[model samples]
Structure formats: structure tokens, C-alpha cells
Target: MHDLIEALLLGIIEGITEFLPISSTGHLLIAERWLGHRSDLFNIAIQAGAILAVVLIYRERLWQLAMAFLRPGHAAAMADARVYGQPPREYAYRLAAAFGVTAVLGVLVKKLGFELPTEVAPIAWALLAGAVWMVLAEQLAARRAAVLGERAAITWTVAILVGVAQVVAGVFPGTSRSAATIFVALLAGTTSRAAATEFAFLVGIPTMFAAAAYELVDVVGSGEAAHEDWSALGVAFVASAITAFAAVKWLLRYIQTHRFTVFAVYRAVLGLALLALVPAAD
Candidate 1:
């Protein structure tokens, strides 16, 4: 029962933090200090649940992207292409480019055996650094938006940078993937907050699912699956999906009117507190 409760709490944390410009992995790591450590497979499973929620939320958009290729001359596809002054399949192509970059770099990172640090001090430092990065990036993006009037077009440069951002986030546990990608897109001249956020979230769906699959295969090959608590994992998965649905929905709406500065402020405070507390605890 206690384990189940812990699973539920961890799921809620994953769901709430996953889509936000706050690091979900950082939150999970902090929670594990008290709730007890979870296996990498369990963490990946909960993250997969969050990814499923994004999939559901963007079902129509995903369908349109598909139909754009599968059925040329699709009305929605034509409209999108016309508005963006690009080919009918441009959006899809950009998404592919971004995902490709991540896949290649991600594999290289894995091959190099660069693992996410589990230590609190490094995570705390990352959180603090990310907060500073967010502030500076947002200011630059806002200035660009003022001049460009909130352009929605994603340039090839933006696409490639966003992809690189994802790998950087993966290498740093406290750097939020969504935060990294979205800000990189913004800084790379994708001025519209909504557009940057959508691209980041869309790209994340596949990136995260791939990572989760890779981790799952590794865990199974190592025979660690046999020791996992299936019931607790199931509860965590369901809890993560439901909470993620709500969290992403809220974020989509929230970003339309607000800047991401609030999240940066929250990150700064939390990071500093952790930094102070961690040394004393040691």
C-alpha cells in the first residue's frame, strides 16, 4: 500500500512537471529521496504515460500532419502551407528534421555512456543554470517577437537548434526538455510562443517514447523486469496519464496569455533552496 501511494505521488509529479518548463526528471529525483528510489524502467514507464497524454491532446493535429502526406490537397494542409508560405508538407518535414537530429545525437550520447547524474548537487546546479538561461532566452525571444510581430514560421535553423536543445536537456537532468526546445526555437527566430510550444510538445512525443522504449528493452535484457512491482507501476502509469492530460491542457491555454517567466522564477527558488539544503544534509 505504501509503495502504491508513493507510485501515485510520483506519477502526479511526473505528469505535472513533464510538459511544463520545469524538469520532470528533477522533480522525480527529488521525490525519490523520500519516497524511495525507483528503477529506471519505472521512471521511463511514467514518462511514457505522460507522452501518451500529449498524443491524445494532439490527436487532430497529428492526423492533419499525416493526411498532409497521405492525401495531398487536403484542405487543412493547404491552408497551413499557404499561411506559412511553405510547401504542404513543410511542417512535417521540419518535425522529421528535428527528430532525426535528436535520434542521431541521442544514440551517440548513449554510446559514449553519458548517463544522467543522480546526485542532488549537480541537479541543483543545473536547475539554477536553466533558470538563468530561460530568463535570457525569453528576453531575446520577446524582443524578436516585438519586431517580427509574433511570426509562427519555423525556420530550418530553429528546427535544428531545437533538436540540439533536446539532447542538451537529456544530458542535464535538471534542464527541462520542453523549456530547452521552446526557448531555442524562440531564440532561433520562431517568435510565436504558441508555435514554439506546439513544436516542442509535438517533437517531444516521439523523442520521449523512443527513449522509454530503449530503456524498457535495456531493463528487460538485464532481467530487471522480473523484480519490478507490476501493480505499483500500473497505478503510476494510469495516474500519470490522467494528470498529464489535465496539466498539458492547462499549459496550452496558459501560454496563450502569459510568459514562461513565472516558471523560471519558481525554478530559481527551488534550485537555490535545494543547493542550500543539500550541503547541510551532507
Candidate 2:
């Protein structure tokens, strides 16, 4: 019963933080330190719930993209089929370009045995650094007077830049993936905040899904899948999916009319607090 409760709590945390410009992995690690360690599979598997939320929210657009990709002579007809003020093919191509870079770089990072510590200290520092980057990137975006670009405006270069940012976020636990990719897109000249946010998340669905799939395969292959608490995982997964859906919805609306200064401030303060409190708790 205690384990189930703990799983529910962590699920809530994962769902709420996963889509926000906050570090979900960092929060999960901190939560685990208090509640007791869980299987790495559990940690990764819960992300599928978050991905499912995204898919549900963007079902229409995803379907359009799929149809565009499958249409007869799509490569030659992309100039005609526009959906949501942009060609669906454009979104498909950009998403693939961005995810390709992330996928390749992520594999290389793992193959190279390059990993950052998931301890609170590293997370704290990353949070502080990401906060500063957010503030600066917002300021830079404001100065450009180029706030007209949408996801349709994401060029190959912008996609690559966002992909690199995703890779960096993967390496550093405190550097939130949404935060990193959005800011990188902004700095790369994605003029509108909504555009940057949408593209970041759209690309995130595949990246996260791939990661979860990889972890799940590893767990089953290692024969550790049998030892997992399936009941607790199911509860957590459902909790995370529901919360993530709400969180992402709120963020989408929030970005349309507001800046990300609030999240930046929160990250900065939280990072500082964690840095101070972690050692004492230990």
C-alpha cells in the first residue's frame, strides 16, 4: 500500500513536470531519493503515459501529418496541401529532421559512455544554468522584432539547432528538454513563442517514445521485467497520463499570451533551494 501511494505521488510529479519547462527527470530523481529507489524501467516506462497525453491532444494534427505523408506523390504535392496555416508535409519533414539529429546524437552519447550524474547537485546546477539561459533567450527574442514565425517557419537549420539542444538536455538532468528546445528555437529565430513551444513538444513525442521503447526492450531482455511491480506501475502510468494532459493544455494556453519568466524564476529558486537542502538531508 505504501509503495502504491509512493508510485501515485511520483506519477503526479512526472506528469505535471514532463511537459512544463521544468525538469521531470530531476524531480523524479529527487522524489525517489525520499520515497526509495525504483527500477529504471519504471522511471522510463512512465513517460509513455506522458507521450500518450501528447498524442491525444494533437491527434488531429498528427493524423493530418500522416495523411500528408501517405498521400500519392506527397513529395511532389507538398506545395498544395496546407493544414493549420502550414503544409502538413512541412511539419513532417521538420519533425523528422529534428528527431533524426536527436536520435543519432543520443545514440552516440550512450555509445560513448558519456553520462552526467543524476544526483541533486548536478541537477541543481543545471537548473540554475537553464534559468539564466531562459531569461537571456527571452530578452534576445524580444529584441529581434521577429515574432511572426510559426512552426511553418522552422527551417532545416532551426531544426538542427533544436535537436542539438535536445541532446544537451538529455545529457543534463536539470536542463529541461522543453526549456532547452524552446529557447534554442527562439534563439534560432523562431519568432513566435507558441511556434517554438509547439515544435518542441511535437518533436518530443517521438524522442520520448523512442527512449521509452528502448528502455522497455532492455528491461525485458535483461529478464528484469518479471520483478517489476506491475500494479504500481499501472497506477502511476494512468496518473501521469491524466496529469500530463492537463499540464500540457495549460502550458499551450499560457504561452499564447504570456512569457516564460515565471518558469525561469521558479527554476532558479528551486535550484538554489535544492543546492542548499540536499546536503543537509543527506
Candidate 3:
């Protein structure tokens, strides 16, 4: 009963911030530190709840890909499809391309990062960096009015940029997944609303699934009470899913009219507070 309650609390926080310009991982990191929950596995697995939200919301688009993929030549044709006439193959190709780069770089980082056990990844820097990027995003949006268009507006460079940013974001929390990737989209000249939100959803499918899997495996490997805690994890996942569903709906509409300035302010304040609260042990 107690663990169930604790998991729900964490899940609420995760679902709300997962897709927002705010960093879900950052909030989760803080929540775990302060909330007295010692289970990294639970934290990680609940992210799947949020991932499911995106997968379902984009089910139609994803379904299109599923059908196209079972057939051959889908990937090649997608790469050459028109902007206005983009089909599932296009989305699949872009995801594949982005994932390819992300996989190569992410693997190297993980391999090298594991070797350096004493290092901290500067998560605070990630948040502060996000603040700067958000501010710049406002300027970019003002300068351009790029729309989502009939199809995804991602080019090869834009896809690469988003993927690379995710790698950096993977380096630290508080650096929001959406914030970093959106900035790249903005720089690649995507309009604010279109670039910030949808592409965030786009790349998130794989990232969150991978994270959820990693956590689950760890929990099982640790011989923790993960099986016993399935009930608790379920509660947490449902709570997070409900919260995320609402947050995503609200955010898509919010970004349509509002600016990223509000989130930037929040990130700035949160960044400074973390820096002040937890100085080095030295």
C-alpha cells in the first residue's frame, strides 16, 4: 500500500513533465531525491506509461507505418517522398535515420561513460543550458513562421540535429528532452510550435521505450521485489498516464498560442534553486 502511493506520486510528476518543455527526467531525479523513494526501477518503468500516451495518440500515423513496413521498398520510397504527400515510409525513414545516428553515438557514450565512474554529467548545466536555448527559441519563432505542414518538416540535417541534441540531453537531466530537441528544430528553422512539440513526440517513442526496458531489466536483474511490486507499478503507470494524457493535450494547444517564455522562466528558477540547494560535498 505504501509503495503504491509513493509510486503514484512519482508517476504524476513524470507524466506531467515528460512531454512539457520541463524535463521529466529532471523532475524525476529531484522527486526521487526528495520523495524518499529508493527505487530507480520504478522511476524508469513508469516512463513507459508516458511513452504509451504518445504511441497511442499517434497510433494512426504509426499504424500507417506498420502496414507499409510489412511490405518491402517502403523505407527507400519514404526517403524520397514529397513534403506534402509524405506517407508512413517517410516517417519510418526519418525515425530510422535519426535512430541510427543516436544508436551509434549513444552506444559510444554509454561504453565510455561506464568506464568513468567518478564523473558527474552536470545536470544543472543541462537545465541552465535549456534556459538559454528556450530564450533563443522565442527569437527563432519570431523570425520564422514554419508550420508542421501537411507532412513532417524534418530534413536530413534537421533530423541529425534533433538526434544529436537527444544524445546531449541523455547526458543530463533537467536539460529537457523537448527543450534540447526543439532548439535544434528551431535552429534548423522549424517554427516554434511545430518544431517544439510534434518532433518532441516523434523522437520520444523510441527513447522512452528504451528507458522503460532498461529499468525493467535492471529491476529484474537486481532481484528486487519488482514482481511483488507489479501492483504498485501498475498504480503508478495509470496515474502517470492520466496526467500525461491531459498534459499533452493541454500543451499542444498551449504551444499553439502561448510562448515558450513561461517554461524558460520556470527552468531558470529551478536551475538556480538546485544549484543553491545541493553544492558539492567538498
Candidate 4:
């Protein structure tokens, strides 16, 4: 019962933080300090749940993109192409580019045996740095929006940089992947907040699912799956999916009228508090 409760709490945390410009991994790491450490497979399983929520939310958009290939001359497809300054197929190509970069770099990093640091101090520092980066990046993006009047086009440069940002976020536990990719898109001249957010989320869907699959394979190969609590994991997976659906829905609506500075402020406060508390715990 206790384990189930902890799983539920962790799932909620993962779901709420996953889509926001707040680091989900950071929150999970902090929660583990009290809830007891979880297995890598468990973490990956909950993350897959969050990814599933995004997949469900974007089903309509995904369906349109898929249909664009089947019916290239369709009126709706052409209209979407004009709005995005590219055909749906081209947009998908860009997404593929971003994913390709991440896949190659991520594999290389894994081959190099680089692992995420589990220490609180490094995570705290990363959180603080990411807050500062968000402020500066948003200001730059806002200025570009003012001049360009917002753009939905995803440039090749933006695609590549967003890919690199994903790797950076992976290397730094406290740097949110969505935050990194969205801001990188904005800074690379994709001025529309909605566009940048959509691209980031779309790119994340595949990246995260692939990552979860890789981790699951690793855990299974290492025989760690035998020790996992399947019932608790199931509860956590369901909880994560439901909560993530709500969280991402709210975020999509919220960004239409608000900037992400509020999240940066929250990160700054939490990061500072964690840093201060770390010394006492030591």
C-alpha cells in the first residue's frame, strides 16, 4: 500500500512537470529523496505514460499530417502548407531531422559511458542556470516576435539546434527538455510561441518513447525487471497518463496568452531553496 501511494505521488509529479518548462527529472529526483529510490525501468515506464498522453492529445494533428502524404493535393493540406510556409511533408522532414540528430548524439553519449549525475547540488545548479537561460531566451524571442509579427515556419537551423538542446537537457538533469527545445526554437527565429511549443512537444513525443524503449531493454537485459513491483508500476503509469493529459492541455491553452517567465521564476525559487537546504542536509 505504501509503495502504491508513493508511485501515485511520483506519477503525479512526473505528469505535472513533464510538459511544463520545469524539469520532470529534477522533480522525480527530489521526490525520490523521501519516497525511496525507484528503478530505472520504473522511471522509464512512467515517462512512457506521459508520452502516451501527448500522443492522444495530438491525434488530430498527427492524423492530418499522415493524410497529407496520402492526399498531397487536398485543399486542407495546401492550406496548412501555406500557414506553415511549408508542406506537411516538409514539416515532418524537419521533425525527422531533429530526431535524427538526437538519436546519433544520444547513442554516442551512451557509448562514451556518460551518465546523468544523481547529486542534488548539480541538479540545483542546473535549475538555477536554466532559469537564467529562460529569461534571456524569452526576451530575445519576444523582440523577434515584435519585429517579425510571429512566424510558424521551422527553419533547418532551428531544427538542428532544438535537437542539440535535447541532448543538453539529457546531460543535465535539471534542464527541462521542453524548455530547452522550445526556447531554442524561439531563439533560432521561430517567433510564434504556439509554433515553437508545438514543434517541441511533437519532437519530444518520439524522442521520449525511443528513450523509454531503450531503457526498458537495458533493464530487461540486466535482469532488473524481475525485482520490480509490477502492480505499483501499473498504478503509476495510469496516474501519469491521466495527469499528463490535463497538464499538457492546460499548458497549450496557457501559452496562448502568457509568457513562460512565470515558470522561470518558480524554477529560480525552487533551485535556490534546494541549494540552501543541501548544505544543511550534508
- Candidate topping lDDT: 4
* Residue 71 alpha-carbon offset, candidate 2, angstroms: 2.0
As for lDDT, the candidate ahead, 1 or 4, is: 4
Task: State in Å the error of residue 11, model 1.
Answer: 0.5
Ranking by lDDT: 4, 1, 2, 3
| Candidate 1 displacement at residue 15 in angstroms | 0.4
Better of 2 and 3 by TM-score: 2
Output the TM-score of candidate 3. Answer: 0.83
Supply candidate 1's per-residue lDDT for 5: 99
lDDT of 1: 0.89
TM-score per prediction, in order, is: 0.95, 0.94, 0.83, 0.96
lDDT of 3: 0.71
| True-structure Cα RMSD, model 1 | 1.6
In model 4, the clashing pairs are none
Candidate 1 residues 102-183, lDDT tens each?
9999999999999777678888888899999999999998998898886888888988989999999989999999999999
Off by over 4 Å in 4: 71-83
Error of 3 at 232 (Å): 2.4
Where is model 1 more than 4 Å wrong at Cα?
A: 75-88
Candidate 2, position 145, lDDT: 39
Task: By TM-score, rank the candidates, best first.
Answer: 4, 1, 2, 3
The lDDT of each candidate is 0.89, 0.86, 0.71, 0.91
TM-score between candidate 4 and the true structure:
0.96
Which ranges of candidate 2 are over 4 A from the true structure?
Answer: 72-85, 146-152
- List ranges where model 3 is wrong by over 4 Å: 71-85, 114-122, 144-152, 225-228, 279-282
